[model samples]
Target: MKPSLLILIHLNDASRASIEAAFDVVYAPDSTRRSAAIAARGDTIRAVLTNGTTGLTAAEIDRMPQLELISALGAGYENLAVDHARSRGIVLVNGAGTNDHCVADHAFALLLAIVRDVPQLDRATRDGIWRDTLPMQPNVSGKRLGIVGLGNIGEKVARRGAGFDMDIAYHNRKPREGSALRYFDSVVALARWSDFLVVATPGGAGTHHLIGKPVFEALGPNGFVVNVSRGSVLDTAALAQALVTQTIAGAALDVYESEPHPPEALLTLRNVVLTPHVGGRSPEAITASVDNFLANATRHFAGKAVLTPI
Candidate 1:
């Protein structure tokens, strides 16, 4: 018999079909259904498919006594109860590198959208306004780009910035060994020195509101900020205030603190651009992430080492 797998996130038909071939899936993408599934089939469930945001709790893990593996479909696993799962001897795996390119691409898309005033300009043009009447936006080339985290995604963002002739610098917990880009000891310092600040840090308590009023102030009135990482990394209230007061030139975000719904504070602002948290989403990315999960789960069940153990 196929192992029972509890799915805790939405999946496209293609992904569902492929996964269905290998396991008996309980397609519970919400709270009520998830709880019911665990209650009804807990003993038979041997695996779980979830993302970082839609995490499997210690209590939930406890309910699934038969669960031997848990897999996060994407790179971010900020909310996952990793330690507890490890304690239960359940193998944990994530698709860390699967969506790096997609995220980097989305980050640049946000940066360019804000820096070039693409959305506003498009609207103005539609309104029959000419360049002569509209305010001039700054060039994206030859700018100083500051990246908050220099991980795999950040490095890819740097590579994209380089193509635009940008002078790239980054702030990490410590200097990344053998990295050629300038390293900043602090996020504020990096923001102060940059024409654009792109946040790519991880989520969780350690980085919650890491980009706040101080960092926004340091970026000055002409600088722009882009967040392609987790929403908790930036203070949405502070960002909205910055836009209202023109504390910064403009801002763009792929994620915000109040997610699944547009931030009420920045909804009416003309200087801000927002996209649903889709930085790591693409057909290619989805396929790669699904394949990564299948590989890890298959190996674990086959009595082999999981490929991307968390």
Candidate 2:
């Protein structure tokens, strides 16, 4: 018999249909359904599919005594109970490189949108306000761009920055080997040197609130910041305060601390731009991610090693 799979995140009809061809799927994309499905089918579920944000907990794993595999749909598995899953010998995998370019594209889009004041300008134009009445925006090209966590997505962001003729630097736990790009030992130092700061770090306790008052203060009044990583990486309260006091010129984010619900603190700020954590979402990216997941699952079920193990 095909192994029963429990999916904790939303999947489009096509993606769901594809997965159904290979396994008996128990679809539960929300809290109510998740609880009900787990209670009813936990004994038979042999695999679980989730994203970083909608992670499977240790308690949930305990409920599913037969679960042997856990797959995160994206690069992040911050909320997954990785340690507990590992102890249970559950095979863990993620869609690491599948959405890197899409996220990088969205990060650059946010940078341009905030720096050029695009949203505000469009609104003003709609109100019949002309260019002469508005403040001039700064040029995005030929400025220093700082990146935090020089991973796959960060590398893509750097490539895009190069196209704009922007000088780029990055801060990581250690400098990436064979990379000629300038590296800073500290995030504060990088922020101090950059006109634009883009955060692409991982989430979880170690990186929670990594961007706060000190980093914002270092970014100064003329700087702009963008985040395409997990929301926990940037403190929303600190960000709102920075925007309100103009600690930094402006900020843009695809992720935030309060998710699903809009951040109430930043709602009134004109200097901030927000998107609902869609940095890695695109038709191309989604297809690649689903394909990767299917490949890994197929290999695992055939008694072969899985790809992209976390």
Candidate 3:
């Protein structure tokens, strides 16, 4: 019999089928079902699949005494109990590069959607409003673009910015090796220097609420902010206040403090654009991520070193 594998995130039929071929999957995409699966099949489960957002907890890990590997289908593992898992000798891996391009594509999409006022313009056009009544929006070209993280997705966002002839700079804990993009040691400083700010940083305690009132203030009244990273990185209360006061020109977000539910405070605001967290989601991205997971899991079960261990 195949090794029992517990899955804590939702997967489409094809993806599930692919994994089912390799392991006995307990599909539990919700808390109730997850707990039930853990209680029922904890003894037999030897591997688990989850994403950054739907992390497996230390307690859950403890329940799965047989679990030897935990795989995140996407690049992020922010919510995963990394130290705890490491202490238990559980092998951990994430699909780091699998969805970078899709996320980068969505980041630019959000940036342009808000910068060009696409959604509002579409509404106005449908309501018989004309160009004479709309406020003039600035060009995306010839602007300084600031990235909050200089990782793979951030680099891709910068490359897209370059296509529009925008100057690109980034902020990380430290400057990335061999990167020529201007680096700021602080997020507030980067925001002040940028015409557009795009956040793609990691989530978790280190980055939670990193983009709050101070960073918003630095962006100034004419600047725009875009976030395609984790929602926890941006504070909803601060963002709502900033939008109401016009502290920043406008903002676009693919992810925000609230997930699964829309941010209530931002709902009534016209200057902000929001998307459900679909930044790193695409058919191509999903396939690549699952394929990466399967390869890593296969290597581990075969007693070889897994690729892309976190």
Candidate 4:
């Protein structure tokens, strides 16, 4: 008999079909359905699929006594009950390299959109305003780019920055080994040195609000910031305050604390650009992630080690 799989995140029809071909699938993409599915089918499930934000909690893991595998469809597994799962001897895997390029591309898109004031300029042009009447925007090229994480996504962001002739640096708990890019021991120092700061770090308590008022202040009135990482990594209240007081030139984000609900405080701010947490989403990226999950799952059920263990 095929192992039963419980999927806690939304998937496209094709992706669903692909997974269904291998397992007895239970689809629950929202809170109500998730609770119901777990309560009803928890005993039958052998594997679970989720993303970082819609993580499977320790309590939920405990409910699934038969669950031997859990997989995240993206690089982050911050919300997953990793230690609890490990204690239970459940296998953990994530799609780390699958969506890095897509996220890096979106980070730059947000950076350029905010830095160049693209959305505002487009609106002005539609209303018959000319460039001569507007304030000049700064060039994205030839600037100092600071990355908050130097993982797969950060490395890709750095590579993109290089294409724009930007001098690049990064901040991690410690400097990444063999990296020639300049490293800052602290986020504040990196912000002070950066013309554009892009946050691609992981989430969880260790990094909660890692970027806040102090980092914004250090970034000064001329620097722009972009966040493609988890929302909790940047403080929304602080970002709104910074924009209101012109503490920073502008900001762009694909993720924010409010999530499914738009951040109310930043709604009226023209100095910021927002996307609905889609930095790592693309047809290509989704396909790759799904394929990676299937590969890992297939291997795990066949009594082999899974790829990309978290």
Clashes in each model (backbone N, CA, C under 3 Å)? 0, 0, 0, 0
lDDT of 3 by residue, 1-310 (tens): 8989999998999999999999999999999999999999998899999999988889989998998999999999998988999999999999999999999999998888899999999999999999998999999999999999999999999999999999999999999999999999999999999999999999999999999999999999999999998999999999999999999988999987768899999999999999999999999999999999999999999999999999
The reply for model 3, stretches above 4 Å from the true place, is none
> How accurate locally, in lDDT, is each candidate?
0.94, 0.96, 0.94, 0.97
TM-score of each: 0.98, 0.99, 0.99, 0.99
lDDT, candidate 2, 1-310, per-residue tens: 8889999999999999999999999999999999999999999999999999999999999999999999999999999999999999999999999999999999999999999999999999999999999999999999999999899999999999999999999999999998889999999999999999999999999999999999999999999999999999998999899999999999999998888898899999999899999999998999999999999999999999999999
Candidate 2 has an lDDT of 0.96
Candidate 3, residue 38: the lDDT equals 96
Model 2 scores a TM of 0.99
* Model 4's TM-score against the true structure: 0.99
- Candidate 2, run of 10 with poorest lDDT: 255-264
Global lDDT for candidate 1? 0.94
lDDT of 3: 0.94
Error of 3 at 35 (Å): 0.9
Sort every candidate by lDDT, greatest first: 4, 2, 3, 1
lDDT of 4 at 219: 99
**Cα distance off (Å), candidate 4, residue 229:** 0.5
